[model samples]
Target: MTVADLVVDCLEAEGVEYVFGLPGEELEDLLFALEDSSVTFVPTRHEQGAAFMANVHGRLTGEAGVCLATLGPGATNLITGVADAQLDKAPLVAITGQGGRERLHKESHQRLDVVHAFEPLVKWNAQLSDPAATTETVRKAFKVAEHEKPGATHVEVPEDVAGEAVDGEPLADHGPVARPAPDDEALASAVETLEGAERPLVLAGNGAVRTNAASALRSFVDATGMPVVATYMGKGAISDRDERSLMTLDSGPESAAGGAVERADCVLAIGYDIAEHDPSGWNPGGEKTVVHVDAEPAEVYADYTPEVELLADPTAALDRLADSIDSQWDAWCVDAHETVYEHATRTPDPGDTVSVSNTLPILREAMADSDVLVSDVGSHKLAIAREFPTYEPGRCVISNGLASMGIAVPGGLAADLALEDDVVVATGDGGFLMNAAELETATRLGCSFTVVVYRDGEYGVVAEHQEQHRGESVGVRFDNPDLVAFAESFGVDATRAESLDEFGDAVDATESDELSLIEVVLSDPPDRRA
Candidate 1:
C-alpha cells in the first residue's frame, strides 16, 4: 500500500465521510487514493471555501472535518478557515500536500514551510517525512483535533512521500479521551458562590454545546432558576424559548443581555472561552465573582479571574453543581429577554426595501427547530447573533471566533451535508460575494439550502463602526450586480424579496431538493449596535 492509501484508510477509520478541497499538481497521489476510497472528495472553487466547509462540518458533527490543499498558496488559503476553527473550538483536520523533500530544502516553485506556517493556527501540526509513521501521524491528527477544547490539526505529506510504498494498517480507534470530574473543594466553592449571590447568572459558550453539557446546564438552571446568557457561538446551549434563557450577549456593554451581566454579582461561566466574547466587554468593572467550569482552566485576565475554577468536564461539573446547589433564585432576567425579543421582531417602517430585523422572524417562522442557520460575519451577523432564536444545540452556527467573512455559503453546504437538515445561510452583500463561487460547488453537489443575502452595497459592519466613530462612513461602500442574477448564473433558483411578506413567501417556495438564493435589498444597513 502507498502512504496516500494509508492516510485515506486512517480517515475512513476516523469516520470521515467527505474531504473538501481543490485539485493541485502536488496532490495528485492523495487525490487518486481518495478517488478509490469510500471517502467522498468534494472539489471546491477555492481552498478557502473548502476549509470553511470543513470548519462548519466539524462544528456541527463534533468530528474532525477534513480538508485538503496543495503546497504554498493552496495551504495558505486554508489559514483563515483553519484559524477560525481553532478560535471557534471546532474540530477539523487540515491536510496539505508538500513539494518533494529535495525541493523543499531549498527555494523551489510552489514550495513553502507549510508546517511552520500552520503552527499558530492549529493545536498540533507535523510534516510526514517518514512513510512508516503514516498510521501514527494520521491517527494523532484526528485525536488532537477532536480532543476536549477541539480545534484544527494539520498533516503535510510530501508528494514523494505520499507515493512511497508503505506497509501498515490504520490505527485502532480509541474513542475520545475521557474527561475527569471536578474536585471536591472546587465544587464546594462554586456551590457556595451560587448560594450567596443574590443575582447570579450563567454565561454559556461554544464549549457548553461542544461538550454536550446542554442537558446538564439546563438541569443546573432548573435547580437554581439562573438566567442563561449565551455568547454568539454559544447560541442554542439553552433553548431560546425557555424563560431562563436571556438570549445572546452582543459585543457592546450596553446590549440588552449586558444588563443582566452588569447586574449579576456572581457569574457562572460554563465552558466559556474568553475568545468568544471577551470578559472585558461584559465585566468591564471586574467586580463580579466568577465560577469557571470547563475542560480547561480559565484564561488569566484582569476582568475574568475566576473565584472558583472547576477544571473538569463541563457536563460532569454542571451535573454535580446542580445536585449540590440548595437555593433556587427567581428568573430575574426574563424581562431583559422580552426587550430583546421585541427589538428583534420589530417590523420595519413602510418602505420598498426589507430590513434584517423584519426578515429574521419570517425566516425563523419558516424554519423548523432542527434546521441549521449558518451566519457569515458582517452587520447581519451581529443582528442574527442577538435576535435569532435557536432551540437546539449546534443548530445556529455563527463564525464569531475569527469572525471571517464568506463562511456562510460554504458553511451552509457543510451543515447540510453533515446534519442532513434544512439549512439557511445569512450573509451581507460583502460576505456573500467573498465565497459566491462556492454556490456553483453547492449546485454541482446537489446541495439543498437557501442563501439569504442582505444587499446593502457595502461592508455593513465596518461602515457601522465608521459611522459610529466618525459620524460618516467612508471606503466601505461599493456597488454590486443583481444578486439574484449572480446566484441564478450558478444554476441555483433565485428570487429578490423587497418586503417581509415576499421574503417569507420566497422562503416557503424554496424546494427542499435544490439550491435556492434570496436577495433582500435593504433600505439601510442594520443598526446592530443597538
Candidate 2:
C-alpha cells in the first residue's frame, strides 16, 4: 500500500471524520487515498478557510482537526488559521505536500522549507522523510496535538514519499489516559488562601471551557458562593444567566466584570491561559493571591504569579477545592452578581439604532439553547462576549487569542459539521466579505447556518477605535455590495432587516436546514469602551 494509504488509516484510527483543504498537484496521491477512506474531504474556496474549518472543528471536539495544503504558497496560506489554533489552544494537525525528494539538494519549483516555516507556529512539526516511519510520525502528530494545553502540529509529506509503497500499520489507539491529579500540598495551600480571603473570585479562561469542566466549575463557584468572570474566549464557562457569573472580562479593568477582579483579595484562576487575557492589564500591581488550576502548569509572566499552582485536571481540582472550602462568601457573591447584572440587563434608550445589547438576547431566543454561535473579530465580538448568553461551553466560539477578522463564516461551517448543531455567525460587513466566498463551500457541502452581517459599511471596529482616540474617523470606510444579492449569488436565502422587529422576523422566518443571510443595517457604531 502507498504511504498515503497508511496516513489515511492513521487518521481513521484517530476518529477523524473530515479533512479540509484546497487541492494541488502535490496532494494528488493523498486526495485519491482520501476518496477511498471513510473520512470526508471538504474542498474549501481558500486554504485559509480550510484551516479555519479545521480550527473550529478542533475547538469543539478536543481532538486534532486536520487541514491539508500543497507546499509553498499553500503552506503559507494555512499559517494564520494554524497560528490562531495554536494561540487559541485548539488541537489542529496541518499537513502540507512538498516537492519530490530528488530536489532536496537543489532549488526546485514550489519548494521551500515548510517545516521551518511552521516550526515557530506549531507545538511540534517534522518532515516525513522516510516511508518506513509514516504511521509512527502520523501517530505522534495526533498525540502531541491532542495533549494537555493542546495546540497545532504539522506534518510535511514530499510528493515522492507519498507515492512510495510503505508497509506499516497505524499505532494502536489506546484512548485518552486520565489526567494527573493535583498535589495534596498544593491543593491544601490553595484552599487555605481561599478560606482566609475576605473576598475571593474565580477567573475562568478558554482552558476551562475547552476541558469540558464548566459544570464542575459552576459547582465550585456556587458552593463557595464566589463571583466568576470569564475572559473573552472563556465566555460560557458558566452560563451567563447563572447568578455567580460576572459577564465577561474583555476590557480588563475597564469592563463591568473588572469590578469584581479589582475587589477580589484572592483569585481562583481556573483553566486560565495568559493568551486570552494578559494579567498585566488587570493585575498591574501583581498583589492579589492567585490559585492556578488547569491541566498544565502556569505560563510564567512577570505580573502573573500564582500563590499555589494546582497543576491538575480542572474538573478534579475544582471538585477538590469545593469540598475543602469551610466557608461561603454569600454577601460578596450577592454584591458582585448585582454589579454584573446591572451592566448586563441595562436597556438602551428608545432610538432607531439597534443595540447589540438588545439584539443578541433576541437572537439567542430564536436559536436552540444547544445551538452554536460564531463571532468574527470586530467591535461586535467584544459586545457578543458580554451580551450574548451561552448556555454551555463550546456553544459560543470566538477567536480571542488571535482575534482574526474572518473566522466566523468558515468557523460556523465547521461548527455545524462538528457539533451537528444549528450555527449562527455574526460578522461586520468587512469581516463578512473577507471569507464570504466560503458560503459556496457550505452550500456545496449541504451545511446550513445563518449569517448576520452587521452592516455599517466600514471597518466598524477600527473606525470606532479611530474615533475614540483621534476624535474622528479616517482611512477605514468602504462601500459594501448589496449583501442580499451577494449572498443570493451563492443560492443562499437572503434578506435585509432595517429594525429590531424586522430583524427578529427575518431570523424567525429562516429555516434551520437552509442557508440564509440577514443583513442588519446598524443605526450607530458600537461603543469603543465596551
How many pairs of residues collide in each model? 0, 0
Residue pairs clashing, model 1: none
TM-score of every candidate: 0.97, 0.96
Looking at model 2, residue 212 earns an lDDT score of: 86
Candidate 1, 312-349: lDDT as tens digits: 99989998988898888877877887776666555544
TM-score of 2: 0.96
| Per-residue lDDT over 1-530 for candidate 2, one digit per residue giving the tens place of the 0 to 100 score | 99999999999989999999989999999999999999999999889998999999999999899999999999999999999999999999999999998996688897899999999999999999999999889989999998888999999999999999989889986876678887899999998999999988889899899988899998987788888888877888887777778867742224656777788898888888898888987688678899899887788887788899899999999999889998998656555556666555554344536855567756877878789999999878878887676778888899989888899999999998987788999998888998999999999988889999998777777787788788877777778899999999999999998888888789899999998999998885543332
Give residue 268's error in model 2 in angstroms: 0.4
Model 1 worst lDDT run, 10 consecutive residues: 344-353
The best candidate by lDDT is 1
Q: What lDDT is reached at residue 429 by model 2?
A: 89
